[model samples]
Target: MPILSRAALVEHLVRTRIAGDVATPRDNNLSHYRKLANGDRHYWLGLELGDRWTDEQDVLAVMAERCGVIDDPAHRTGQDTIDPELTVDGLERMAARLRKAAAGQERVLFATGHPGALIDVHSRVAAALRAQGCDIVRIPGGLVADEGYVVQFADVAVFERGASLWHTHSPEPMNAILDGLGEDGRPDLVIADHGWAGVLAQPVQDRVHGLRGVG
Candidate 1:
């Protein structure tokens, strides 16, 4: 399949949002949209990379459609519930891809701009990497605000679970995370969330082995 232009992809996302057929924010957090909504139960879309994009758009538009509420009282339906799709198996596949791509490096660091207390998933990831001969590290002591930049300087650096910050058009945290790594002498690979990869394309190229997870 030919790669679609970024502009075309963005347009696709916009159309999907206007159609009210996109996934909700909570579902996006879970990383898959609903494949089918049957009354109260939602069948989740599998989280294949192909499922992540409609042309070039990441799952952002779907989130806006599902979560962004309008204040008009006329549109309010008290009984309505937003049901979105999600699958634990699919998220595991994504984590596995990250683990596989980051394999064989001297050190693998998972850095996130969010509070460290919220990232228990990293511990499981670290154990998995150890079993597979990879040295996985987390930014120490749960003090995430200041130490993320340092973590990204390792042989392989990754940002986990950054979707909202991406779609809302925020770049400062992402920049601080990358710039702190010293662009002059950067790491071998910079694995990031899709939003960071979109804006920091060149820095990634000049500093590391290019961005991972733009999909």
Candidate 2:
């Protein structure tokens, strides 16, 4: 596939329902937000929430600010929206990070929870970075329990040019990878989404870049 310009990418996001009238329903978002506010371990995805996030409204507010989701507490059902502008802004920011990594020949790791939708994008970026001499790190391991189901490490495949990830919402995979890092070892950059992104960002905020509100 051809690389899309910023404007073209924004249009693609909208047309694909990755942003603007997003496929994630408002009710589902509220349910997740409620779980987060209530301190549900499974939903927290390795984030350490402060006491101020005790209320669901507070979570909603934060989501709205970061993701451009509707802020209204009254929104109970139907399609939730992700502002295309916010999606574009996030993509641009990610692109800038990738550019820096390429320039520095940074060691980078890529993972995702929305593999069905986003693998192509990540693979292309990984290939580009490889062309620039960046080492794309491959995490090796086996299946691990997440919530209830087992997620295989092979499901998240690392190749010569890029990697392919399967769907996963739990942070366990990322935590395992971080735990196994060598002393004085850390990827210079991590590209990921959903819980994978959140977990990686917790310990090393500067080296991780991700899109918020993607399911």
> What is the TM-score of each predicted model, taking all chains together?
0.37, 0.78
Assess candidate 1 and give its lDDT: 0.38
In order, the Cα lDDT scores of the candidates are 0.38, 0.69
What are the runs in model 2 whose C-alpha is more than 4 Å off?
1-6, 141-166, 203-215
Looking at model 1, report the run of 10 residues with the lowest lDDT sum: 39-48
Q: For candidate 1, lDDT tens digit of each residue in 1-215?
A: 68656455445545655322443333333323223222111222111122324421223345435443322323323322222222223344566666554565434445333323323455455555657775554333222332232233232233333322112222334454544544433433333433333344544345343434332
Highest-lDDT candidate: 2
Q: Enumerate residue pairs that collide in model 2.
A: none
Top of the candidates by TM-score: 2
* Candidate 2: tens digits of C-alpha lDDT, residues 1-215: 69888789889999998888888889999998898888886677656565757799988998899889998999899988888988899878877877888898988777767667777777877888899999887664443434332232322322111233446666766665655554344577777777776765554443342322221
